[model samples]
Target: MAERIFKYVVLGGGIAGGYAAREFAKQGVKPGELAIISNEAVAPYERPTLSKGYLLPDSPPRLPGFHVCVGSGGERLLPEWYVEKGIELILKTEIVKADLTSKTLTSAAGETFKYQILIIATGSNVIKLSDFGAQGADSKNILYLRDIVDADLLVETIKQKKNGKVVIVGGGYIGLELSAAINLNNLDVTMVYPEPWCMPRLFTAGIAAFYEGYYANKGIKIIKGTVAVAFTADSNGEVKDVKLKDGRTLEADIVVVGVGGRPLTALFKGQVEEEKGGIKTDAFFQTSVSGVYAVGDVATFPMKIYDELRRVEHVDHARKSAEHAVKAIFASELGETIDAYDYLPYFYSRSFNLSWQFYGDNVGDTVLFGDNNPASDKPKFGSYWIKDGKVVGVFLEGGTAEENKAIANVARIQPSVESSDALAKAGLSFACKI
Candidate 1:
């Protein structure tokens, strides 16, 4: 077995890993002290792009263009960026075993690495239909997007099956975004989900109605109240049709399932305290195991704003929590003080020239505003979550930067609302003033 050592090691080269490495470099790390072990062949890039620009038929974002930090308008950390900083980029390396107590990780190739500090940013894995024992799920062209490999394969399949029928299985952001993308490619798109409406986790029925209608206007089919149960593959094992639980069969040239994701915590299971289907961490992103940190989708940490422990799966929290972890590490080393992480849940999605932003918790009674007519030109609308007369969350679609900022502020400050009527009447104007 090969053996190596590093003072700091970031496991999983995703958003949290990349950003954590960047923070470590900023705080100062000597040559040979920092290393990033990743199963991917390339350096970390913006994963959110996989469902968006990367799927675009025209001028898709290429590597180094959408690297981490670039999404947030920071310096793009290309492979050379690590080289220049004397940070080792151990790409295409998968850790097969992790002994947290020993502060060591063994790769699939039997290579072992010891670290003084271990950042567990392993991220997540795509939920496969096979996981549910769906028949014929191994059929070819039955794809799921998670990493660049998955996105690239989808792109190639799109080219091979241009103007073909695409059945997107799932109504969340992935399904919605890919529906728009496949439609833009001049293909027939049909979305499938078991929910009454799309994005039930976030979108209100009112909000979903607009998108459902808008998607219809875009010539995309929305099949709600059902799910894909099995797939029919051709003699070549390529999926040709999708069998639905609701007894509706759809001809599908390509099927993409985006049901959901589970955090990558199996390696640390029983070795770490877990909650909410993720490794539990404090505001500082430090796990129960000393010197073992967690971030990104795998880290369920305290959300001070909500006064409850929350696990944020969005890219914003990934970047922020990674940097915060590094800061906390260095602070402890240098005997300095730092504030606990206080994060406001922020999520956004863009598709078919329409964009939306949401901030804060999405609980409580909702108040919808603006025109939600799917066919209207420049249709703008928003919603507010009111709990005990205070706005707990804000959602705005087709908002200007300034307007989005205003709603974000409302979520941040959580100002009190006198009445729902006044809040509705004021609408965007209400947030603008606040």
Candidate 2:
């Protein structure tokens, strides 16, 4: 008699999907019982570095961190790993439609597969300039830093026009990082944001001002309180300029759009309950559909700190949610009830010479701390959110080892502002003294 094998099918082979498939395989699932499907030809790869490391000439080619098999050097995730682990790899395939009632999925190639369990890790897509009508919307000089292909195109374009003007249309992490990198190439760079400060969504007004000055000091043109309305092109169909909502026009040879990313839940549009343009999932990362799970950028789950539902598109959230989704699957397999997934959300980014780290939810009244210099190299700052005198969130910039630990401690205790002198102690030495 043969052992009963539980078949698992993972859709979307990006970070979230790849990690979930690897976890399911690690649980002693047989290759014949597991299948990983990806829409792209190449295996899953790390995406966060695509905007930074992959764009640089000195950095090594980035590959997917999650692997199934051990190779000759035991470095790569080989096809044999899936074979030995009883997991099948389906490359260059896409799940066009999913039938939850029949527990089956149909691929674009017309191949059908049955899965006892399914994981949706489709991740998110970069918000393009077409949505904003920026210069790079149709020009060959325009590029996005979303995937390896985009990075490669950007490298080629940068090499061809080493001294051209590069205009970035977002002050978010990706936009800021890319602007810094392109500026390093000695190209004239300009960053445009609708908000008055950088990273307005992630950082407090003071911290955002700090970064605004940080970029401005590096000779990068920072255009705030302006939104890109349309693109201006030359007769040759090349991007020549960009029209701003403030009745200003900026000349540009290249345009990069990094406005933000939206969840890639289009395929599951009618299947899942979506709000704010993302799939609505429960505490366990389970969607409205049974036996089906959604994780990463696609999931909008409840946050204990915010006391409301939120969707996070950061890489840390993707990794943590994948772990929780796997645990939920295991519990379901054993017919055991599981607890809700509760983890503090965190994200980081590097621009110029500064590294920014943030934790918890910044959805409440914020108390600012540290040095508030927009031009200081050693400036460090922190923001704590208090509700009913209890700390619920913390955001730190130019953080120290002690500050990192302190932020974590604050999260656990839900501390009151009076308990710690994070503000007075750090004082003028740190940025955001207020």
Candidate 3:
């Protein structure tokens, strides 16, 4: 077996991996001291664009344009940047086995990798219908977007099946974004979910109502409180019909499932301590095992602001956590100290001339404010979540950059709220003042 060694190695080439590499370079690293190993054939690029701009019908976004850092408004790191920095980019290599005790990683190939310090950023894998024993779940054209390869496949399918019928399974980010993307291709799109509203984990009924109405206006059908139980494929094994639990079958040329995802941590199952379905880490993102750090979707680290341990799967946290982990690593080497990660949970999505941003917890009572009419020419609205007499969360649709920043601050600061009625009446002004 081939053997290689590096002082620092980052696993998984998703958003976290890319951001970690950028941070390592920024913090000063020897040319050959750091290496990133990824099973993806291409270098790490922004994963969010796969569902957003990449699926657009227009001159859609292509790679090299959306590489790391750019998504967060930083300098883009092209494939050549790694070469220039002498940082090894090991692509198309999957590490099948991890031995934390020996500090070694075994790839699917016969190669072995040894590292003094390792960063686990394996990210998450999509939950598939087949995992639930759904019939014909393996049919062709039933795609899930997670990586560049999946995005490319979907793009090609969109071209070949222009104006075709599409059934979106799952009501989360992927379902909403993909429905809009396929609709833009002039395709007939239908969304199916087990929940009564889309993004049930986050979007309240009022917030979902506007989006559902907006989607209806765009001629996208939505089927709520039901799920796809089976998929029927044509002679060529392409999905042709979706059978739902409610005894409804919708004709479909393509099916996309986005139910949810779980962190990729099976390789290190018994090797490290885990929590919240992810590797457990402290404020510094250092796992129980020394010289090992976990970040991004795979790290269930301490959420200082919430005074708890939690795992955030959003892109913003992925970027920030990766940078913070690298900073902590360097600081530890110098026997220095840095502040703990105090993330104020942030999430956002954009589709069909509508964009929204949310920050902080979604729990507690919610107050919807502003214009949310689906048919309105220009609708600007927001909601505030008040918990324990404090504004713990904020969501705003059609917000300017400055307004979005204001809401984010409100979430971080969690200003006091005297009365829900007055807070709703105050609306955007309350956030702006805070």
Candidate 4:
């Protein structure tokens, strides 16, 4: 069996892994000292673009285009970038076993890797219908998106089934975004979910109203309070229809399921401490085991700002946490100290010339503001989550870059409000003034 050694190893080449590699280079690493092991054939690229621009019917983005750092407005890191930095890109290698005590990782190909410090950025896997015993879930053209391979397959199927009837199961980020993406392809799109509204974890009813309305305006059909209980396939073994729990069957040439994701933590399950379905980490992204760190979707780190432990799966946290982990590691080696990670949760999405950004937590009473009319010539709207008379969270749609920054500032500052009605009346001005 082949064996390799490195001063640092980042497992999983996704957004976090790419950003971590960039940080390592920035902090100055010796050639051949660092390596990134990934199961993907390509180096790490922006994963979010998979469900967004990559699915666009016209002039879709292809890789080398949406690579790391570029997603965050920094220099794009191509596969050649790793070659230039002398950082090994162990592509198409899946590590099936990880021994924290031995500081070793074993790949499915029987290769072994040893590292002084390990960054666990394995990220998450999609929740599949087959996991729930949905009949015929394995039928062709029934898809879920989590990685580049999955995205590529979806794109290929979209072409093979042009202008197909698509039944999307789930109303969260992936489902909503995928619906819009498939719709843009001129496909007949219908969304089905168990919840009364979309993005129940984040979007309030008032917030969901605008999107549901807008989707309706775009000719997208939505069936709420129901879910796909099973699937039926044609003789060719391709999914032809979706069977709903509500005794309704919908003709579907294609089906996309995006219920949720589970962090990939099985490799280190018994070797490390885990919480909230992820590896527990300190503010610096250091795991319970020294020399082993976890970031991105697989990390449940302390939220210094909220004074609690939390796992953030978004790309923003992934980028920031990975950078923070590398900086902490370098500081510790130099016998220096750095402040704990103080993260202000941020999330955003874009589709059909519409964009929205949310910052901070999404708890407490919410006040919706601005023109949310889906039919408006220019629909601009926002919502604020107030707790203890202070703004704890803010969501804004159709916000300019400057306006988005202002709302983010408000979320971070959590400015106090005298009255909910007054604050609503003040609207975007309240955030702009702050």
lDDT of each: 0.93, 0.74, 0.93, 0.94
Per-residue lDDT tens digits for candidate 2, residues 1-434, read 22222477777777676566666755656557767788877666666666765565455355554242221123355566567776777888877887777777777777787887778888878887777544447766767777667887888888887789998988888888898888888899999988878878777777777777777888899889988888878888888888898999999889888888877787777777887668888888888998788888888888765567888887777767886888888887888877787777777887666776766666667777777697665887767776776766777777776766667666656655554365346542333221
* Cα lDDT of model 3 by residue, 231-292, tens digit: 88899999999999999999999998899898999999888899988999999899999999
TM-score, predicted candidate 1 vs. hidden true structure = 0.99
Give per-residue CA lDDT, model 1, range 206-308, as digits (tens): 9999999999999999999998999999999999999999898999999998998989999998999999999999889999999999999999999999888
**What local lDDT score does residue 116 receive in model 3, on the 0 to 100 scale?**
96
The lDDT-based order of candidates, best leading, equals: 4, 3, 1, 2
Lowest lDDT block of 10, candidate 4: 298-307
lDDT of 4 by residue, 411-434 (tens): 998899999999999999999999
TM-score of each: 0.99, 0.88, 0.99, 0.99
Candidate 1 achieves a global lDDT of 0.93
Overall local distance difference test of candidate 2:
0.74
lDDT of 3: 0.93
Candidate 4 TM-score versus the reference: 0.99
True-vs-predicted CA distance for residue 260, candidate 2, Å: 1.6
**Which regions of candidate 1 fall more than 4 Å away from where they truly are?**
none
True-structure RMSD for candidate 1: 0.8
- Backbone collision count in every prediction? 0, 13, 0, 0
